[model samples]
Target: MKTPEAGDAIAAAPRRGPLHGLVVLDITRVVAGPYCSMILADLGARVIKIEHPDDPDYVRGFPPFVGEGDDRFSAFFAQYNRHKEGITLNLKHEAGRELLKQLVARADVLVENFRPGTMERFGVGYDTLRAVNPKLVYAAISGFGQTGPNALRPGFDNSGQATGGLWSMNGYPDRTPVRVGTIIGDVSATLFAAIGVLAAVREAERTGQGQMVDVSQQDAVLALTENAVVKYTVDGEIAGPLGNDHPFVRPYGQFPCRDGHVFFGGYNDKLWALSCRKFGTPDLVSDPEIDTMAKRFDPEVYARRVKPVVENWFRERSKAELEAMAGDDIPLCAVKNIREVVEDPHIAAREMIVDVDYPQGRIGMFGTPIKLSRTQAQASGRAPNVGQHNAEVYADLLGIDAESLQRLKSSGVV
Candidate 1:
């Protein structure tokens, strides 16, 4: 692909701040890729999420569809696709494939999670796209990688956890391997995708050439559990799961209090002494055997010595009192369910949940975590209806007449 000439690099459409004039075309559905696009969208990029016309986003038909049959909207879709425009493209058709090629010429970033060979099979691979646009960043999220023995394998989040090391590190030693409560591995891949996209974008800005951002679910999972990986490699000892307890650290997990449980990690002497003082059991300070890491690992001695004292103290104190007493000397947090967390003062103050207007009055938007002060990121748009922008985007961008647009719609092409 030839480099863009100064004349070919026309003045870009301005946006509010950073990511101004950026264009993103997202072809992936469900969690990971959508999460990456959502972050980019929140950062002021114009993200166009392409869905198939005949069989829309699988999320449209995913169970928990609200209101009516095939409503074309779902909670899962709404959460992942906030702050983006959506249009349907029947990629199975030649005309539709050509349209994608055209869009690639103008787009800045293209994201997809189709099985390994699907994009190349569609004639819209990077080598093909770069001919039209040299600075087009193509991102792929796959199970293993774009090329590998397991590259084409389906990257189900739970299955990836099992294949990755997370499952082994999740449960108690003797129990069945447990998967995490939510889509953790998927989020992990999304994080990797986000980092890759931004880095590629930065490189393209410097060199005026785009590159491939390949993210593997397997790689992402292993990347996340770094400590466990290092432990295994260093000692040749498989890191075993210890449930709510830390394997190497003492009293570094959840403990039951009067109202509920509280998680605390006493990582050092100062914190450990503070915990002991708070519980009015300062005797823990003098025991040189209990004070050090090696002594704490003596399971029988440590368990019998610490458990009775810690449990009795926790059993007498309420969660609030324990939280107040523990202070910042140790990391302590009361276990909170979703309902409690939604109502939490810090969460509310941080605007983690905002009232977003929907057809059914106002629904909460549990928004993205990052808060940009100078240029605030928001879901300026909502999750779109299928082909909602058919007239605006197709007719305007594709330069198709209204009659032709309607004709294509009638022919199920839009």
Candidate 2:
């Protein structure tokens, strides 16, 4: 089987967006790190995805593949890797390490997700690379960060959620704590890492000095618990799952409809009054037991007075009917399933669901959420095959000619 050339199946589109001209060396694999780099790529950064020649990224073999034979590739991998260039370099090899250093000298940022000391062992850690290019912003995404007792411990999304106290607070109070629907730990860390990288890059540009941005999955997930930590510390109250209910707000939860469920938020007094009128229960507004926000916030009062009336109103209507009634008056929305979300008029209008063309076929993925008026963030092009840009990137970045690149490939260096 003949291998595809650089940009053979997926041609490189002209760079646009806010991050145009930024050079990113993405030496990460799998979800977290690749996702962060993908965000940068979507924002118009020139991201070069580097991988080991022999091993490649594990996600390349993941399921839900597209195409067949040599043209086959993982849809899951493409979801996070699109709009970036790909190259393979055996970083374990001394020559490959030297070549990476040369590339680093020209890069503005480098992102990696290996364990704490992996880069140091390879002699290309932040401290080493920062010296190679003093203005380079090195961002490291790890399970437990680069410091503390758990630094060396292997961490994953589940472990991060478990140790960070997010897992214990999810699900129903009577049931076993469930992990969040998605890999929130990894994803939150990715967002934080990207922010840190951009912030550090800005600083580097101004001060002509670079620094390391350390982002930990556990730390990021813990930070996103939304007052769970403070509620325990300040009020001496350990919060547990309340199903779909808000902790402090009455009538702020999912209510049953004829067809399905709808989330209704009438927590404030004004909204409560508005909701009461909208639900054809205006008399409930002046009821002494649950008249004001404070009274409705009382668990006993809400359970006895508020829940029954609001739930009854919702149960009498279908999701569509309830939505139509709510309109712009009440803060409510029908709970949408995945199919509904994909087909939703709002989602379509916002361009949240986008289709990217590939050699195999056109696959739909989520578009960028960040919308800049001038330099719009967008996802373009398809992901590259392993080492697809070896010759191009090597020759372009390091001045390595065709002869030298072939020699390096022959020596198992790139």
TM-score of every model versus the real structure: 0.92, 0.95
Clashing pairs in 2: none
Model 1 regions lying over 4 Å from their true place: 1-17, 63-72, 297-301
The digit string of per-residue lDDT tens for model 1 on 250-312 reads 767888998999887774677767778877878887787677655665677658876666778
Model 2 C-alpha lDDT versus the unseen true structure: 0.87
Per-model lDDT: 0.77, 0.87
Q: Which has the greatest lDDT?
A: 2
lDDT of 1 at 311: 74
Q: CA shift at 154, candidate 2, in angstroms? A: 0.8
**Tens-digit lDDT track of model 2 for 91-134:** 89998888888888878899999999999999888888877788
Clashes of 2: 0
Which numbered prediction scores highest in TM-score against the true structure? 2
